[model samples]
Target: MSIELPQRPFFLAPLDRENSGVDFLGLRQANLDMMGEMIPSINNVTSYIRPFSLLSWIYWKFHDLCTEAGIEEATSDDLRLFRERIEVLFTWGASLHETAERIPGISATPPPDQDGVKPLTFDAWGRVQSSTSLIAALWYGPASKTVTGLGFLSPVPGRGGFFRVSRAGAALAQALDNKLREDGERYNRLLGTLDPVEANESDAIALWSLWSPETVEHEEMASFSSALTSEEAIGSNDTLLSRRSTTFALARHHLQEVGAEQSIPKIRRGMCFSVRPDGSNYDVPTTLEECRRKWLTLQMRQLQRLALETLLSWCEDQILRYDVVDTSAMAERFKKSWALTEYGLGEARNLAELIFKLDTKSNSVEDFIRSVNTNDLPDPFSIMAEITEKFRQRDPGFAVPCFFGLLQCASFAGAENAPPNMVQLGSAPRLSLRVLRHRLVGLGDVTVAEAFEYILEAMVISQHFSTAVNRFDGRNQRLRLAIEETGLTALVSSAWVPTVTEDRLAMLLTLSAQSDLVSKNFDGEFFSNGGIKNESI
Candidate 1:
């Protein structure tokens, strides 16, 4: 038997999440009902990921690789190797150079003569030639996680340190800017006339007024973008970020200090990476305030929600879990039947709800191209906004539209994709299988494992024998049980195993001494006789 070394420069596993099942799904705590339309979960840049933190990470990683890039021994292989090292450091917070100084064969010093030739000679992240290219390659938000076309992130041209905000990004920024101005003016007019900003107004308008965007930077632009975030959002972010590595934070903060302590802040080699436009000679077309980005996000969400209604109508026609996807009602017109709270959004989410929408942003089906030629065109801003949004979805994994469940409905909005289930499932599972197991054990006195085993054993026995049980009502089932002391043994021999009513099955399990399966559950009550099956688990 033989073993081969895996081709990895940083031989450390990515860190396990600090909080494994944190919050159990953000929507449960939100004002919105988790059972209603899809929840708002920013897949990335959730409050915990501050621009400062990201900037800090990029800055130090560059410093670590700058020297290596300048060395003569650098090769293409060094790019991949050191890129992995730098990113691994960012993800797991491990130092490769420190480890190399400690470990065995990897830590050994190459002979003095070969030091300038071999990148693997272990002088540090030694082989990497161009730090900028490495930064660009790794900067596109986890190539493995993005589900977008050309993700919103397109690193700045020469210095790959900062990514340019795409035109679509600019539109989202502009869209939010427009909405903020509109809402702010509307609120002023109503308040000046002393007429109340009534409930009947658009939720966007009402929500805009409610947040008092006046408190944020731009007084006139009081949109979801300009408004100070809810206390809840702030608290959630602080709690999460507080748990990050203290060492990582200190080092990052140290690198960002100014004055004699100021080591370029975020500027290096005459190049700058900054969120604010600091006259550092680094420029990008647009840097929409955080508020604008959030605004564009909500606008897209509004459309996605509308598309969802169309999708529900679709799944109904296709007979694809129609009962779950479309819960019909005479009066509850806006009710989303895609899931019930009891089913907890059920299997609808796992139906790969967002991939098709994501695909549209890139390919824009033939239907969209045809529709574009029609005379009833929307304003150019809107059309461009939609177009740009689609382009932003190029990242294959965490496309914002999909992650937020705001799947692009371009073809979908005009009644969108007939998205087929991708051959392989990529969406992260929304529900925990363990949690599902626990819920399935619903009301049982026995552990989930025990009940599962008992069911398996019962199934095995039923395969071998059949028996009969006669009821007091003159019903003669092919199974026997109830008072039978053999209990579940009746499951093996009696026809009752196959022919008995659910009530009798409950009685059999209730009477059995070892198997603690109970019948008090909703299904048990619905399917079985009143008394016996009523025994709650």
Candidate 2:
């Protein structure tokens, strides 16, 4: 049976401009609906989860696994990708036009002979006219265009729609101004109260207070309006520009340079694409792409951390609601039957213990949300920060179920995969199967059979190293022995082609072996275990 969660209105944290009561959650729902209509891959409700934390953890974990396996080649490839990304950032900064020229298909200029004709395009991005409409299209996504055409928010007189929207935008700007002023006051107060040692620790907060509002110049607003409305606007780049938060930063810096003195216009209503206005200053390297890469990367990290924080908060709240206060007390609580509970206390305890190190002393959920600083955590992709130390441990226990649920949501796995055997089996085997299923399902867009082969390939590569063993357990015996005695490496290597049914069955059997539910000989194959039913496979 599928895990059917109670239906509730989907919630999306508001963007800076959307803070002016712009119906952020409504817009996100509409966007999701529109995207589902446009792209088959994103049609499922589960697709909305966007589990960046889990995905990043898996990738970094895989990297660690590769290093442990002594697959130097795979590790070296990671280094290559890292170096290339840095180089790409440098290139993006130096000259966007030049970089576009070097990348054959990437073009800053329109196609030959089509430059003069006005182009209107529609696709997964919805309908857009040109750069002129970019601000509107991106702010509300498809909602702006559709809502406008329906005359709900038309620019036509007496509609009051644009007026309301414009007012909303104005409200957003006012809110930011108010916040900056407040932050400035707070910074001064802290500076005055704190000693030198304490002051040094407050640098990040102080920088935030000082730098955020300063990034905006009161004069640059008119130039920004001009850039949005200019006759030279093209729609193709508008989609790219709309999705990019750094574009706003670039525009602000430009207006500042040109000395445009108009107040920054209230962000138009429906424009919810702006990143949280932390007021980071950008010296703006020579190229737009560099600025974009830096900003996007930073926002991604921030977003992932925010999502994780949200999850942790929810988990903590669940634990508190259960009134299980002490860590040691959880074990006793677990002994009681959890038949009526929506989730076992065992599960809640596991999640709490895992993230216990990261928990703060906030009295309420709101307080935690307001005060928790994501920057205090390690870098976004760091396993210790995102997945925490619990996952790195051999058995994460009670945390397994919730994480598996998250993994299912992230992968857009159909309901058919649910009510897994783990539900009936005891917790230990359940955890192993859940982890195995996670690895199996998380493999790149390939069929289960192909995924099986991919794992086999990793195992084959791993077998070459005599020291390699399953990281799941401290002992390095089974996999190593299977590799050496049964010529498992040679067998798997010979079957390097696309996956066949038998090969998939073999891999499933191997997973069963890993779970200790099946007996295995020196060869990496499973033998009959009377305890496991055929349907369990």
Compose the digit string of candidate 1's lDDT tens values, residues 271-338: 11212223222222232122122222223323333222222222222222212221222112222221
Judge candidate 2 at residue 244 and give its lDDT. 24
Model 2 Cα shift for residue 421 (angstroms): 40
Please give, for residues 54-127, the per-residue lDDT of candidate 2 as tens digits. 11222333344456756654433443233222222222222232211121112222222233321211221132
Give residue 399's error in model 2 in angstroms: 3.5
How many backbone collisions does model 2 have? 9
When summed lDDT is taken over every stretch of 10 residues in candidate 2, the lowest stretch is 494-503
Q: After superposition, how far is residue 517 of candidate 2 from its true place, in Å?
A: 62
Q: Which stretches of candidate 2 lie over 4 Å from their true place?
A: 1-109, 114-133, 139-154, 157-218, 221-384, 388-537
Alpha-carbon lDDT, every model: 0.25, 0.27
Best by lDDT: 2
